[model samples]
Target: MNKDQVKGVGEQIKGKVNETVGKATNNPGKELKGDLQQAAGKVQKAYGDAKEAAKDNAKHKAP
Candidate 1:
């Protein structure tokens, strides 16, 4: 996977951990931040997926 994909996945995992911790500690702010981070990570991963798909399509179309 590319950097974006890797970073995105990492962020998602980190966010999940933070969310779980926040919930356990009764911290709404931390939970909200984790939710935001997870959302960003999903977007970034989608972008990376699109890039990879485009690259593959281009290769297949090459003469």
Candidate 2:
């Protein structure tokens, strides 16, 4: 996958770890941060997906 996709997945994994740790430790702040990180990662991954789709579409349309 592209850099964005890789980084996004990485961020999502980290967010999950943080969220789990937050719950285990009873830290609302950490939990919220983790939630935000997951959201950001989702957006980044979506963007990367769109980029890849565009590239594929372009290649298909090219002579």
Candidate 3:
């Protein structure tokens, strides 16, 4: 996986932990922040996925 993919996954895991902790602690703010972090991580992971797909397509199309 690329840097973005790895980082994204890491962020997602961290976000999930934060969200769970926030929920257990009854902290809405932390929960919201965790949700945002997860969203950002998803976007980053998608971008990395697209990049890898494009690279593969280009390689396959090459002579």
Best by TM-score: 2
* Candidate 3 backbone clash number: 0
Cα lDDT of candidate 1 equals 0.90
Model 2, residue 11: distance off in Å is 0.6
Error (Å) of candidate 1 at residue 21 is 0.7
The TM-score of predicted model 3 comes to 0.96
TM-score of 2: 0.97
Off by over 4 Å in 3: none
List per-prediction Cα lDDT, in the order shown.
0.90, 0.91, 0.91
lDDT of 3 by residue, 1-63 (tens): 788898898889888988998999999989988998899999999999998999999999999
- Which lDDT value does model 1 have at 54? 92
lDDT measured at residue 28 in model 1 versus the true structure, 0 to 100: 94
Candidate 1: tens digits of C-alpha lDDT, residues 1-63 = 788899898889888988988999999989988898899899989988988999999999999
Candidate 1, poorest ten consecutive residues by summed lDDT: 1-10
Better of 1 and 2 by TM-score: 2
Ranking by TM-score: 2, 1, 3
Q: Tens-digit lDDT track for model 2 on 1-63?
A: 789998898899989888989999999999988998898999999999999999999999999
